[model samples]
Target: MHQKRPHVLGIDDGPFRKQQDGEVPIVGVVMEGATLVEGVALTSFPVDGAEATAFLADWVRGLRWMASLHAIVLGGITIAGLGVVDLRRLAGELDRPVLAVTRRETDGSDLAAALHAAGLSERMAVVERTPPAWRLERGLYVRAAGVEAAEAERLLRATLHKARLPEPLRVAHLIGAALVNGQSRGRV
Candidate 1:
């Protein structure tokens, strides 16, 4: 009997300047069981206000490896400043599991205030509708749709190599940063 490796598309946005509005480059790395780099997708999305779910869903659907993908993982729920990626909507649209991983728990009140101040109050609703983050090992928090907490954890665990984060995400972060800054400097 042959066992199939888990294939995941992990997404992360490049570093962007605050108080500035523009599109931010993002990278998506596809991996087979957190070891092999299957492929990479490169794109950009509007910053601060434009929602990312539709853009991402359409982009992902166009990928050549879409059929074999086991999951879509995001570095964080929010990208390109205040732009929010709706997990539920993405999962429903793609008919596949979608998960977001964050290093720290968010401060809901602070985020709401920031969004309101940025004149993007509607973004708060997306945050509110998202399911709570489940704590993974070493302060990693995961929020997933189309999959339960246990399975989400298992998926993440199965997708990790030597890095603390999944290989797809880690590589995507490095690529995005290097593309924008000549070289990656900070932790993702």
Candidate 2:
């Protein structure tokens, strides 16, 4: 059987304020191969809150084109403070595989310590439940749900263009940053 090109939706959250309680903007980009199909935005609980999974699932479910998406890609497992993504819940709700990508290998110990310091120790369990990150290639690591490691790697390879990150993810990051800062900065 011939494999179809996956229509992937990449999600990312904008930067947030450090000393205040507020919502953070989250951006989702839908893409097929190198073509961008749609962009959607939502808000999540302030940094260190535990509502990312439910908020994301609800946002996705409300999209009219949700059924056209084949897989989901996230910029990271945490967004807007320490709101952790429940990979299993997201995948189960969408009935699609989900992948979280990071630019560097994460130090679990450091993350746990930070969460503890932030009074978000409860988030550690959710973080621990995320599948361990696997190196998709040099400078790229990923954790996935509902997809095999090899297949995830293949999808990443196929979707990556000039950067190690997937195009949809890069676009989402750029859009998210621009919305927050008026101008985008950092490596996309």
Candidate 3:
């Protein structure tokens, strides 16, 4: 018997300065098992705003390939700085696994503090309710919903190429930078 390669959509926010106010572009890259790029999704939302989850949900639900997606992976839990994503809600609404993966651990307390300071205390509550990160092999920290630990590992492994992040995410980061800055730059 042979296993199938998992298809995943990886999302990442475009470049933004901490002092910037207004919307920021977000890029989503879809890949067939971390190799072939199937498609891309694009959207934007306010910086440090509280609508991250809803906006992301709408962006994903609008995808033509949403039904076939095995999972949705994010570059991080927060987009455009303090905009937080409710992992559980996203997974439930999309009926797919959702995972936020990072090269290093993003302290939950720090995220909570940012939300609280931004006066997005309501979102802070959601952040508090969300599960903490689970450390995967190779120093990747993943905060996930709608998938078991074993399945999460399988999905991540399926999408991983030679980079530290999964292919979709890696490619999405580069695309996002180019979209916003006219060319891909900085750390990907």
Ranking by TM-score: 1, 3, 2
Which lDDT tens digits does candidate 3 get at residues 1-188? Answer: 01267889999999999769988888899999978999988888888877788889988999998977999999888898888888999999888889999999866777777667777777767777677788888899988899887888889999998878899998999988998889997553
Over the stretch 57-159, how does candidate 2's per-residue lDDT look in tens digits? 8888887668888788998888786788889789898888889999889867877887898888988888888888877666788999988888887767666
C-alpha lDDT of all candidate models, in order: 0.85, 0.79, 0.86
Of 1 and 2, the candidate ahead on lDDT is 1
User: How close to the true structure is residue 24 of candidate 3, measured as C-alpha lDDT?
Assistant: 87
Candidate 1 weakest lDDT stretch, 10 residues = 1-10
lDDT of 1 at 68: 88
Model 3, which residues run further than 4 Å from truth?
1-3, 186-188
RMSD (Å) of each candidate, 1 decimal: 2.3, 2.1, 2.0
User: What is candidate 3's TM-score against the reference?
Assistant: 0.93
Best by the lDDT measure: 3
lDDT of 1 by residue, 1-188 (tens): 01246889999999888887778898999998878999999999877757588889999999999998889999988778788888999999998889998888875677788889999898888989888887899678889998888778888888887777888898999999998899997654
Residue 126 in model 3: shift from native, Å?
1.0
Clashing pairs in 1: none
